[model samples]
Target: MPKQNSIAITGAGIAGLSLAIRLRQTGHSVQIFEARPREASGEGAFLTLAPNGINALRALGLAERVSSLGIPTTGIEILNAAGRRLALLDEREAQRQAGAASITLRRADLLEALRQTASAQGVDIRYDHALIDIERKADGVTLRFGNGESAHAHWLAGCDGVWSRTRRLALPASPEPLYTGLTGTGGFLDCPHVPSSGGVLRLMFGESAFFGYIKAQEGPVFWFDSFTLDEETAIGRPDPAALAARTRAQHAGDAAPVRDIAAAVTSVPRAYPVFDMGHLPRWFDDRVVLLGDAAHAVSPHAGQGASMAIEDAVVLAACLTAYGAPSRAFRAYETLRRDRVEHIVRISRRRGAKKQAKGPVALFLRDLLLPLLLPFDAKTTQAVQRYRADLDPLVLPAA
Candidate 1:
């Protein structure tokens, strides 16, 4: 009876796409609805897939295939405004401690990989179906899309991203994402003078902002910067040029690479306010359950958002298969994931606070204290990367 029910997923991003594949593998009829057009993804951002992220995708048999999307990343080199190295968080050590290498690639590339995998697996994904409303029934849910289409499913998984309409509709009391008062933007560049970064990613604590860059041997140098943003400035979601200018001004005197990259990147990537929603008491109601950023949006400071969602997909699918119903499975999933995800959210918030550090005293204290804390932070990250979303056995509740 459990496998007999139809499953519907909202959002065709990593979370929904992965979940759809998992649910299909579990013998569930799954359909995914994505509000945006198929081409509306990738957004000029790049990401690093940590070992744990690779491990999570491995559970879905996707690790090896997606490896083609990015280059291997060996370590993170942390530096100050003066280009003085603070610490190099060695990924080799992390790999020894965890079990996989990190991959650095464009956010678009990863999505394309997942999208291809999902499609190849015969997952039913419908694009341009933006969810507008959902009607909850005892046995299932009726979803209304902006395209004037309505569909019903025995179970609904809301894998919609940070601005999830499903969360708002399904759980009215869920708090809005809390703005961390930080806005970030980044771009890619190909400069002849800039050498290949190989497996190293550079992170700089600049005088007025935070910057990071990852180079793909002879390819483009992907860079990003985050700085403090007041409510007024962040409201309009500053244009790319303005963001670029601001970033250039902030990092002009930091380091040669930072300055060079800033000067070369003419595209002022959109500087959107970074927000995290970590106050939800529950992630589901009856047949409707939230997943990924829809449930708990984590700041990019942790770099675990995608991994966490991928883990959630695998675990939740197992729970559903084990418990044979939505309520119990969702509750178990929540019980298993809430603390971990919320903790990551808190960590990301704190890490982001460091990027917004202002004043000479604050910068001095941060630079002074970060080295002492680097080892511990690296250890914690390695441990986090080793986490496997293994599920214990579950029995259906008695009728």
Candidate 2:
């Protein structure tokens, strides 16, 4: 029998939970620590899971479970602020290529699904145990939490998000997440007035702001808007009502459908500033490693953040299964993921720059060039959605 290695995972977000499930399946013992209470895990805005994300979930036997709970979007329509059609990118071909369709669901729902699956597999998840400090030892690593508890593991993986404490502790000189100068505000609307969009995601490039919405087959519409703001104005959080009002004012007279969606929002819209991390020289140190947003955080413009994290989890698990030493496994995992993640980060930043165009010339150039660039954009989507994780050989032994 092989020796069972115990691993500690920080941050019970998508990356951590997915890694826990994958590691357990690979015959490793896993423990997950979450800074936030378990109840707060399910609170967040909606996110799209592309075909690549679906493929990763399928590797864990979770594709169908998540698909049953999310709305499938088959296409996207790019429009001008005046509601004029710009271009349409149908995802049917991409879906066929990847063996799964794209889905959009609340962040909480996905996290809950991951949590339940991990818990069912006997992964210990400790909530409110925020990681504060770490001490590397010869045989393993010692972790200290904010609650004054300590634990040692053969290896530690940091799956924390953009503002990761683990990354800070592991790489004291690592770059901080950089603000993209854009703020996003969005919410659900029960009474959307747009024509049935055939379950296609609608993206409107407004004169001054960008708006996106999708109407589920039998549910309320999900919508969001993004616009550029100065660093001073974008630093502090804004009230939900005030944010909604600001969104409406920004998009007023641009597109009727967007306006209708904004007016229909009854819930106080949630707001967040977009941020992404630049490339780091290293992602691992000795027995400690970083995963997901802790290593590379792409702006939402790419729609691949969650998917990328899922990919990281599967690949890291496979590396651990293949290599006897934790350090070697961490090196292999970083080598496999760094280039791909960094490329996506660059692509996402470019997309975000276009969406946050402020000057009239910049907006005009974007509007004029976007339609002509649809073909290239379709190719980009294919590249992002067609990734498949090699997970067969790493599946856990039957109990």
Candidate 3:
């Protein structure tokens, strides 16, 4: 039988909001607390939604709305710095194989969609409320907020993100976020130059560096990621003009289009510090649990960070619904998610290695090996996309 419980979720990002909605539907009362107030500027950037993420959202009755807000990406093309096409992905085949088309949209748009859906479902969202500390006892957990307010719930799910307070409280010994030796700087622009019909993802690789761009609704959004020995943190502070100028000066010899895209953006692009967080020893203990970036944050090289978080939310909620208790449900969620998330981490590491490869010799080797390996890669992605679990069955707590 299902237990009567009220769950407190931290962070208003996709994972927290989705979890709140799913749990509420399963008869748990949920309250969400976000650091940023309702009118605050969101994490500015763009993201691509894999078929799996779309399907998960669809299952929650949000597919159509969110899909409507994005531009469908047809294919991906590898290019040299001169804008010459190198290796092109078989887009139609990829779509048919994955069972759904991929979509890309600004990160803010996706957040808004999630917020609307969660709000409509009656999930209580308290913006401008930051989580300060968490105390978990035998019976439940208590959350203290920055507003001098506190709340006690049967369980606390920390969806708070990389610098998670809840995660810090639960696992104090966990490694602090390590720089992956790469800086991600990106922004949108009004570049009407790039053809919309040829809306292909372009990746230009060089010595220990890579540049990528895709057509966005507002314009052409582009990013430059460089693997450098000089490590610097790129989070929080946004001065788009300076980031754009710095990147342009750094990658001048590489490619003109990439340089142009970087030069075009007037706004300070969101700078992302490349951090790959390894799996924790336990995703949950007692009445507290962690979700999304709070638990696992993969490098953006794999392009599945956001997708994985959304998938985690859905999976976690399903586990709780099936297991009917916090401890059992958290165990099930960790078991199901660990392997998949770890697989992505390893795959992303491999991709990062490829990105670090130097010059033409490395490019030739990559070209030779990637095609032979592409089919297997595609197949693994297919498995992740088709994943589904029945929450009802997992809800059966011990007799």
Which candidate number has the best lDDT?
2
Candidate number with the higher lDDT (1 or 2)? 2
Report how far off residue 393 is in candidate 2 (Å). 9.7
Clashing pairs in 1: 240-268
Q: In model 3, where is the ten-residue run with the lowest total lDDT?
A: 390-399
List TM-scores for all candidates, in order: 0.94, 0.94, 0.88
- Alpha carbon lDDT at 140, candidate 1: 74
Model 1: what TM-score? 0.94
* Per-model root-mean-square deviation over C-alphas: 3.4, 3.8, 4.0
lDDT by candidate, in order shown: 0.82, 0.84, 0.72
Q: Count the backbone clashes (under 3 Å) in each candidate.
A: 1, 1, 7
Candidate 2's displacement at residue 118, Å, is 0.6
